[model samples]
Target: MHVHNSTRQLSLNEELTMSKKLIALCACPMGLAHTFMAAQALEEAAVEAGYEVKIETQGADGIQNRLTAQDIAEATIIIHSVAVTPEDNERFESRDVYEITLQDAIKNAAGIIKEIEEMIASEQQ
Candidate 1:
């Protein structure tokens, strides 16, 4: 029974580690309010869903903590919730991209994550 419990725990941990990490870009035309808000929402949702997330925001001022090429390569998916076209689209090229509305990003972040999770599961199957 003890060995069985250990095996189950290890399996759970391995599943969590294998789950994809998502890199997201959230921006708006002005890149002020909506951009950061969406990033925060997505980050929170990813955490709750047990996925790692790295977010980059393009604000009116400039890009903030921009996503690196390495980040893009390592991430399993990309989520773009923006009013304007993302400036750094090249890095996400060939990646699984999810384009969503800013409002939906904020109000339904968890649902969005679940949708992406389901999509990935189906694709893998």
Candidate 2:
């Protein structure tokens, strides 16, 4: 019984330590459709996966919904869906970063999240 209790406690602790937030930086060469579309797709996918998500867009309109230091710190992972280099990328230098194309983010956002989730689970194991 003590062993079972300990195991249960450890599981709970692990779950608590797992982050529930995601931060995405989406950009494109023209700062147009791909940028905003990818951001929207990622946000929707993250939300459907029950994660608190913040998506920053670097487009022709410039950076919108810019992510802050606190957001980066709380995120489980930082995803960059950009054709061009994302701005302020130094902020994610020490983060668990995932890179994907803007089109991929827009078309397969759910798959991207699922893959990340699997990666996280594997790391925990």
Candidate 3:
């Protein structure tokens, strides 16, 4: 059943490719509580949704877990949860991006994830 095994392997690969990868930038004007809390909320929501996510926080201390070129290339969407625009905002110029306030991100991270998923689904149709 070599042919059957090959077909199964290809299906698995396709499934992996279809899974969404999200990159997020979180910040706040004060660069304090809201920045870190929103980042954590987004991370938890993404994990629960079975999507891959990377979050970079720009705060008083500066950027942490900075997104790389590879991270940008592989991501399906960019989420910006901030009070002010992030330092390197132009980096996601060509990507599909969703912008939300830090307050919304902190209060309803899961809702944001659901909205993104719905957007992706509609685009595929």
Candidate 4:
């Protein structure tokens, strides 16, 4: 675990509390490897780029880490790297959403995150 030299250790919840949130959903037709691989890549990339990630992985079992209404409302960015359309996708109807393939997310998540950072920067200006 990465830690800072501070008087107190921060829990995961505490660390994420002040963060810029990024929400993602990753799925694939088979609901197997690609579904999980892409979600992990995207989450790692987002965290390294200073965003807190809340990811939903859809597979044969079901969705994990499902996003809540509050999570969606607070998200600074939303990405869907999916082969199959997500089950509850309409939650983002009024939000700016980005889509990518599972392969793209797994292979180029750093580049994807950098681009997203730039996009947010330009929009803020």
Clashes of each: 0, 0, 0, 0
Cα TM-score per model: 0.82, 0.85, 0.83, 0.82
Instruction: Name the 10 consecutive residues with the lowest summed lDDT in model 3.
Output: 1-10
Against the true structure, candidate 1 reaches a TM-score of 0.82
Assess the local accuracy of residue 10 in candidate 1 as a C-alpha lDDT between 0 and 100. 24
Name the runs in model 2 displaced over 4 angstroms. 1-19
Ten-residue stretch with the least lDDT total in model 1: 1-10
Deviation in angstroms for 119 in model 3? 1.1
Pairing residues by index, what is the TM-score of model 3?
0.83
Tell me the tens digit of each residue's lDDT in model 4 across 16-55.
6646889998999989899999999999999988888899
Judge candidate 1 against the unseen true structure and give its global Cα lDDT, from 0 to 1: 0.78
**lDDT, residue 41, model 4:** 98
Question: How good is model 4 by TM-score?
Answer: 0.82
Residues 1-125 of candidate 2: C-alpha lDDT, one tens digit per residue: 00001111225665588668888989888998889899999999999999999999999999999999889767776788888887888887656678888888989999999998887688678
Query: Model 2 scores what on Cα lDDT?
Result: 0.81
Candidate 3 C-alpha lDDT tens digits along 1-125: 00001111224455477557888999998899999999999999988888799999999899999999788767766788988978987777656668888888888999988887787678557
- Cα lDDT tens digits, model 1, 1-125, are 00001111224445466557888889999888999999999999998888788999999889887999778656666788888988967666555578888998999999988887777678557
Candidate 1 ranges beyond 4 A from true positions:
1-19
